[model samples]
Target chain A: MNKTEYLKSLSNELGHMPYGDVKDIIQSIEEHFDEGLGEGRSEEEIAASLGDPKELAAEFKDGVKFNQIMKKRKRLKDYAGPDGRGRIFVILFNAFVGIECWLLLLAAIIAAFCFLAADLAFIGLIVAGLITGTLTEFMVPFIFLILTLACVAVFLVALLILGIKYYAKGLKSYIRWNKNIWNYGLGED
Target chain B: MNSQIKKGILDLCVLALLEKGDSYGYDLAGSLARKVEVADGTVYPILRKLASEGVVSTYLQESQNGPPRKYYHLTDAGRRKLDSERDEWIKFCGEVNEILERGETGGKADE
Candidate 1:
């Protein structure tokens, strides 16, 4: 078969594919023929080497069909939205269970800060006692008490910093999880 | 080789060839057909598939003797895929050879 006949047959066989794809395939094949002819090969030789137009068309059709199905599946997946029951369950769980857990965490964090403030206040009271000479009668014991209090305050400060850091991280991840459930349902990464 | 088997490996082969350097459709088809028993037209569909998958990209370059040729270049994704697919192919071949060699020994022992 000559180049024209070969392309004609291939184009006819590719009737099921989109026009753009068919055009592109035909153009590429035509260029293949042109390249062959440029190298002093006959149209018939190139056409023969390319195999049957029907078979080539079948390959192209299969590839195109597979791609179309994949694209359609992706579109369907996007259109599916989050499952209603799953979303409702997530919402209810967040409202009833998750909210209580979050509130408890908030309360714990606040209580921790309160304790840290009280430690600071105690340290201030010790310093005041030292400055006013009220604790001069028990100077040695009072010094030891102030040093112990200072150590406790340092430890509390460190604990509060770490606790706040982890709490913020956990809260951020929890919010992300809720958003994911709301948008993509369960088990969809 | 079975056509089905050949079809599966053809994609990998095309990617491997492109990984070497950018090549036009005709050159790729010629090279593949020389080594494998595929028709010259077979590579086009695979190229289209790879292009659609974003593993390979194509550009038209002016040819000195003929019309502009569409050159296929391997993308980064294509290279990574080649590495993984090559490893899998090697492992698969090893397993197949072992099984075939065992079968051969079994057949010889029976004889």
Candidate 2:
């Protein structure tokens, strides 16, 4: 394709993006052609080397999306900086991030383990109570109580794992996005 | 070279050029095209990204040829980034070279 056709196609494909970004990409392409012509190269030569404009536009969109994610992610950086505000945002962010979230999960796990162990001990005590003649009347009901507590602990641990599994998936996406940015900036190094 | 690899280093290559002196889009892109297998239009996006990230800043200068052109200069952050990346790149290449050299001699030794 010639220079004009190539750029028009790219601009059309990227029309959904913000205007300035499209303009910048278009201007950059124009400048590329301009320089190529100045250096005694054909527009076809440059265009061929640039590959399909559709592909180029896709890359441009990916780049813009990546940059937007990076900017949105920088809200955390801003909150870390002096003069942070937006208490609601901070609250929402705090629910999902930092040492506190992990600690909360850990607390739930520990609480579940303690309950499970306690239920087992209660079961042992109830068996002992039934085997001997001490507190024989309370044995059956206490056995049921231990069974209920064991079920609750198992349920609690399962819920925590499911919740953490979702959280881990979200964290993985963020890490992947971060890796894209890193590869863009420092991957060659 | 792989285009993916090319995309990763486009910013570093631009920074390497700007570290020498300020350069307009066309000039830098031309030099890069001559040296690297990168697309001519890729440099501007990187320059825009660097400017937004506060790594590099730009100013318009009147060109002798015709119109005013945007010339990019490295910021302090850009300088620090270039330094660290350059150091890491050297070390990375050195390690790769070591393994390559080992393969070259070690294969013979195994025989």
Top model number, DockQ? 1
Query: For residue B76, what is the lDDT in candidate 1?
Result: 95
Candidate number achieving the greatest TM-score relative to the actual structure: 1
lDDT of each: 0.90, 0.75
**Where does model 1 exceed 4 Å of error?**
A79-189
Q: Each candidate's DockQ score against the native complex?
A: 0.60, 0.22
The Cα error of candidate 2 at residue B32, in Å, is: 1.3
Per-candidate RMSD vs. true structure?
Answer: 26.2, 17.7
- For candidate 2, give the DockQ: 0.22
